[model samples]
Target chain A: MNPSLKLAWVVLLALELSFTQVWTVNVVLIVICLALMIWRRVAIKRLLWLTGVPLFFASALVWSLTLQGSASHHFLIVIFTRMFVYVYLGGLFTQTTDPLTLTRSLEQNAHLPAKFAYGFLAAFNLMPKIKAEVASIKAAALMRGQVLHVWSPQLYFKAILTAMHWSDQLSLAMVSHGFVEGAPRTHAAVIPLRHRDWWLTGGSLVLIQVGLFIGLP
Target chain B: MKAWHLRDIILVTILAIFMGVIFFVIGPVYTILSAALAPAGLQPLANEILLGIWVMAGPLAGFIIRIPGAATLGELLGAVVEMFLGGVWGASTLISGVVQGFGSELGFILTGYKRYNWLTLVISALTTTIVTFTWSLFKEGYASYHLGFLAMLFTVRFISVFLFGGVLTKLITNLLSRAHVVKNVR
Candidate 1:
């Protein structure tokens, strides 16, 4: 599936998930998402860790509600199932799609402007550099007899300064390379919107609606 | 609204990514706090308390860029980066970003995009509180709680949003101006 289409599907379903409280629908969606993740070979270890936090939280929520006698069993189930539905759906998108490909698809197919697309791509590509710069900033702070904790404004301030410097250099380089804002640009590869993308997206939408209708409280 | 220069776009993306790191750092804290509160049936309060920090990107980006949608874009991108960093929230992260960012943008919209002062920041915080709280009323099942509990949650969330989104953002922007890094928007 095209990355853009997958993102759209995930986002829309997440929105739908938020508005409704149907545990049966939630359960069905979770199972489907789990199946998709497994079929896609999303790393099981990472998926376990990723889903575990929500599982813990969901259990805690249900336990607390049970103890308080404030929520019904169905409500508890709804809350519990809702959390995993979100995680699995999200995990499916993140684990399956490459960020670079997503960006390219957004630019090529989603009408995302070249400026925002390339801008995001540039910064997205800079995660490692930003990490290194943050570490060096902390080290430099230690050398200067100033301890920069994670929540310290000085750490972010100094780090952002370096980031601003890099942004300046980066934009300069792009402009020098003839990267014009709002200009038509060619792509090395095309991310076509296949018929299957539409079929999957539409099918999921209809299925979720049907599930919602059937599970109406 | 001025057309976004390539520099502006890059700057927002980088700063948002940086904010994402901060959000990631806060994730564990939120989990610990939520876990601690779970026994008391107050797990949701943990989100109320820490939500302000999560919203910092919207106001911070709005203040720096002084553009119409900068806050929304910054926040949305911040959520993207967080998800990229393996946040546990999944697809909800992006939706949360949209809600939060729109809330922050409302403050700037109310000001007609002219002011970038304490008032603007405070209003942004207030609007974010109202907007996000409204979202919670539906999404987080706040409607099920007692009115008093809901009121208490709202108050805590307001304070959290004010301190982090308003005051902390001011401090960062202040530092940037003092260092002659970003062109002073004020």
Candidate 2:
């Protein structure tokens, strides 16, 4: 499956999911999400946390939504079902895909501008290291008798300064490697989007329509 | 350098990654806060407050980079980072990011990207809250509510975004400016 297409499908279903008022439609979508989770062999504990976040948040809206009558109650349920399904799809995507690969896929598949695409990818490469960098910076500050509080503005300022220094060196390296601005770049590999991906996309749309039909009054 | 320089990209990325980690930390707190507030029917308000913090990166990026569309790009990239870290909102986060980012970016655009002052930042954050809340009312069907209830939602959402996303963002940026780290940025 093309990653971008998968993103489109998830986003589309989520749009449908939000407006879906029919209980049966909501149930069907939830079931599909659960099936995906099981098939992917995601641990039950992790699945609980993944789905739990949205569920907890949605529960808060129930009081406000259900204030008047059973209509609001029904709406609340539909919203819960949507959140579960949406979280599952999002979790699955992020869990399975690599960020750098995602940027590359965007560049080739979506024709995202090269400067923006590679620039984002370069940033993605730096994401995992931010924590270590912050820690080291904090340690140095501590050694120098500079107290840093988590909520303090100084903490973030320090972090950005450190990151900016790294970015300066990085941009120079990128330029040195002959990455020119406004220049066309070619992909060494462009994978084909399979027929199955299209089938899934179409099938999901149909399912969503059927859900709306059954679920809405 | 042009408006969207390589350094700006790197800065946005760094800010995005940093904010993503912050969201991860806040996720559980948000859940707990929402649940605690649900009984008072302020859960929605709590949700808005939590979102205010998330939206800050846009204005922060915009103020620091002082470029066209910097806020929107920063917010979008931050959303991507959140999704990467398995944020609970899923695909919805991307939509929220775009809407909220563009919404916040409006304040900067209105100022001709010349004023990164307190008032502009506050307006930027409030604009984000207004934009996102309006969309939520439409999408979540809050139109079913009474006028009083609707007003309450609007007020809470504004305050939350104003304090956290708007004011806090300016505070952090000001600190950065004082430290002279962003000297080369603008």
Q: Per-residue lDDT of B66-157 in model 2, one digit per residue for the tens?
A: 88888899898888888777676778888888888999999887877777788788778767877888778756667776778778778877
lDDT at position A82, candidate 2: 62
Q: Interface RMSD (Å) of model 1?
A: 2.0
Task: For candidate 2, give the lDDT of residue B42.
Answer: 65
Per-prediction TM-score, chain B alone: 0.95, 0.90
**Runs of candidate 2 exceeding 4 Å displacement:** A67-71, A139-150, A210-217, B1-3, B179-186
Off by over 4 Å in 1: A64-69, A215-217, B182-186
Cα lDDT, model 2, residue B72: 94
Shift in Å, residue A33, candidate 2: 2.5
DockQ of 2: 0.55
Instruction: Please write out the lDDT profile of model 1 over residues A1-217, one tens digit for every residue.
Output: 9999999999999888788888888888888888888898888898788678888888876675565446666777788888888888899899999999999999988999899989999888899888777778878999989987655778778867776788899999999999988878888988999998899899879988988877575
Q: What TM-score does candidate 2 reach?
A: 0.88
